[model samples]
Target: MSNIVSKSSILILGGSYFIGRKIAEVFEEYGYSVSILNRGTKPLTSLNIEQITCDRNDTECMKKALNDRRFDCVVDVSFKDSSWVENLCDTLDFETVKSFVFISTSAVYDIENLKIPFKENDKLAENKYWTSYGLEKINAEKYYTDYFASMNTRLIILRPPYIYGENNYAKRESLIFKHICESNPIIIPKTNPKLQFIYTDDLAKIINHLFKNNASGTFNVGNKKSMTARDWVNACAKVVDKKVKIIECDYKSLNRNVRDFFPFFDYDNVLDVRKINSIFNEETPIETGLSNAYKWFLDNKSQIAFKENIEKNICEILAKSN
Candidate 1:
């Protein structure tokens, strides 16, 4: 992270998963110096980036891993716990960091009476689906803002809805692909809830743009249009060039939860993208993103190990035909 290397240095907190991995690759491709700090569980084999192996919560390890290195930007991609934010910041050389970016979630918004397009200034309260997770994200944002305010370090918060694309380990896209590919019925709720999504590479581009512009503020990043469950299924189906069977059931009538049989719940969480779009508007369309995801699933199908219970549960629920 020292200026000796000469390229702009960016330190990523979690750099092995979908969003973090995409950001790392994007930065590296554009000739930026990139470094990753995370537990040595997942390896970014494709990129030859410097990786620091340590638990983020370990104060001693954090101090040793970071040392006194300085970075042009510090990106927080997987800070689910506020304590982790405090632990990392407390251990870091704040003055050495030029800017900070925290990857927040759309869950920070209250679910009830949600704005059609959720803005950054919308209400933030606990909801059943994301109560603890959302609250923790809110706290993390607060802690980072409060901590950096006194230091005058530029801080940016990005709240994104469902992040999807190639190599998504969340099973949201792959689950749909699995059902359609296997000729299994895709069960969905009667209510069609529109949800927002952001492609992995598009997000990477946005972050890179922000870094280049030295932007700092809270932003809701996603595609302007919303996609319903059927829209998602249709996109994946088109990738395979096949028509599929769909079973829409009343979610409330079922004893088991709708999420037990599906990846996304029957609810809307679309985000407003006016601010981000005004800055960087090159967004990947839903059809293109799903096609990319389908290609990745085809390549990694044999390697993907799905929970048998989830598949079986989908079948069981479809049998009742409720």
Candidate 2:
């Protein structure tokens, strides 16, 4: 069935998200039929796309939604559970699916040091039962990679460190812009710790590259250059031409509530992107991305409804733990 003129019918697992939506946009622009499997709360206007609301945790629901149809590719940006992925591998098999792309995280790498860049073959985290959110993703990647090793379904694992841009769920740019607009000083543990960041649009381009080239390996998507936390804050400030002080503080002194969830401030694992650069050389400058993100924040800040679920969930969990 594969031919030079063949177009892929792609099923994006978390197509409502920033990165997932951008990938769908790029795929549709290139004449591919894209469908999404999400919560179906977000409205999409793409004529060539369809969305099926299915909770990712429900195995029977997934099998029902996918059993009647086959997809050329499945881009899973929300596959947090290893069991779900393994079940899909067994059910879908190689005969029904061609490619599987799992959006893993660079969080799978050890970040105790801020100097070394992580390679694609670096050791994954060993502890899945503890620590940050990396373990779930790590297990999912391993399951997919091993499950598809003997099948016709080629596995592609994309590990992105930190993603920011318009329609971002992380609210990283919004957080920075809010502080900048309020003239409130941003705080960092140190001015020298570096981190990797990639804009959502740029990431979409990389996913498109994989689609065209049939790249079948684990690739890292991040800027070639790493930026210090202080530099990033200052860069955002410079982009907006806002004068705001930056407070330097120890990790321990930051609000315990915020610090408990955001422990990356104390570590940096720079990603080695030579393999990514070998394919897509056009990189979005951090300064330019900051400017665009700041503009988006300025234009849409008033429309954003702040949800307290994160705060509520954190407090509830903490209270139970105590």
Candidate 3:
């Protein structure tokens, strides 16, 4: 084990989960003293990291667990409500913490009149598709900005579109991989909207880069280039070395909720990632990232939980179309 350095001390809230888990591993590998705070319900897979068991929602519990510990950076990936941010700000001592990085979503943008490749200064509104989730995230961003400004703490906010990598709880890549493995036809909406995806490891690297440099500001983070939904599905198929047919159908004709049925959401939420890319030029190609995600899904297929009944509904639609 590397000697823990005080300057590199880091705390990750909700580090037991997907994106946060990857960040914890990367920081630990880089010889940082990594500590994770979670509710202790999920299993901690990362070795040689400090674990603080406490509910982030409970202000008192958070204070008790993290009052004495001071970290150079706090990477928060589990905050959903604005109140959660308020609680964390009220409890943690910002005097010692150099930076606070929040994992925000691109859904905060108003996609109704959104321009493609949105920049950091782009106008944002509550996401219509994920109404409450987007609104709350917006609120959380405001709270963090306001509270951190008062304390003169550096704040970095990352708005990533779709984050896919190993150990993903969301059924995004796994759903497509499952159908491709079964030799089932993939169903998608007729419109081939542009989509953006950031590999979890790459996101972790971005967080680490921002912290090391003490970069502060809201930045849009994603792959350099955006691909259409059709290309994305094809990439997934190529990853598994399987040839699967894609059936694009009109959602109205199928009389089903397209967003709920398809893997990619209806909006073309691509972010202009030049700002982050300028600092760190480590953009993982779509093919390479998708291949890694497919491999992980195959290895952990049995443990993954499928949320959508896409196979049954897609097969029925295909049969009816025939």
Candidate 4:
């Protein structure tokens, strides 16, 4: 007997955190029956969605959990390497799965040789800066595209840069928020590199739109505009109505990991989203998104695990400058 599944039924892999969580929430709000597969470490806040607790790394365990189950669409936000995608394809009944969406990264682009406003078809190179993370994602993308094509299944790949908004565990916005709240100087690299960001909510909407329209292709997803590092810090400050002191220092003088000291480095990582914009109209402005992020930070500051020691490093830089 064939398995019966609703047209709107969707399954999200790694829906317990960040982008995946938002995707699940958006699908649920749109009245889609949502199911999530993740290791039971993080408890899903949403009670309505079906939860499958299993580690994707464990092939046998994952296969057993999703053996008979099937869905119209599968969104994979957890795949880190090509092996994981291979494992999933090997285990799942592809005939029952119509669409497979993979959340990839803009890091897959060759950062050193990349031009401004990178397009979807731009050549991808090994990410020397981020090292293995980007290379692995690129491999995963290749595997998914090839595997799904061989199976004659629909595949959608989304590469987004610097996804931000509420529930962002990454120190992207929160680092600035912590400084702004405490009335500290926002230290930045002297180069004042341009950066691009995509709101998590906006990304979620894009995923939903693509799934509904049955869009299949590799697309670069990001806001239409780009902002400088200083502008990003100022925007965060503006959201909280805080006066910020901007201190620009030489990148080499900081003597710390760029990722640790700066939210974004002195590189133009902007993505060309004309293709996606042609289909999805709603783009969240940085101001609005930063404001919303600040609101969430205020309500959940205590819970946030502040990972970077940006403040202490800034103080040390100041002491040396004196």
Which ranges of candidate 4 are over 4 A from the true structure?
Answer: 1-7
Candidate 3, residues 188-264, lDDT tens digits: the string is 78887788889998998888888777799998889888888888889999998999898887888667777546876
> How many pairs collide in each candidate, listed in order?
0, 0, 0, 0
lDDT, candidates in the order shown: 0.84, 0.73, 0.84, 0.84
lDDT of 4 by residue, 256-305 (tens): 66655676756788999999989987888898999988888989898887
lDDT (10s digit) by residue, model 1, range 74-190 = 899978687798889888887767779999999989877686688899888878888799999988888888888887678989999999988788888898898788887788878
Q: Supply candidate 2's per-residue lDDT for 63.
A: 77
Q: In model 3, where do residues sit more than 4 Å from their true spots?
A: 1-7
Q: Is candidate 1 or candidate 4 better by TM-score?
A: 1
| Global Cα lDDT for candidate 1 | 0.84
RMSD of each: 2.8, 5.4, 2.1, 3.4
lDDT of candidate model 3 versus the reference:
0.84
lDDT of 2: 0.73
Candidate 2 lDDT tens digits, 205-317: 77767766777899988999888877888888998898877655543433443343222445564789999899887888998888888887888898765446643433444
Clashes in model 1: which pairs? none
Q: What is the TM-score of each predicted model, taking all chains together?
A: 0.95, 0.86, 0.95, 0.94
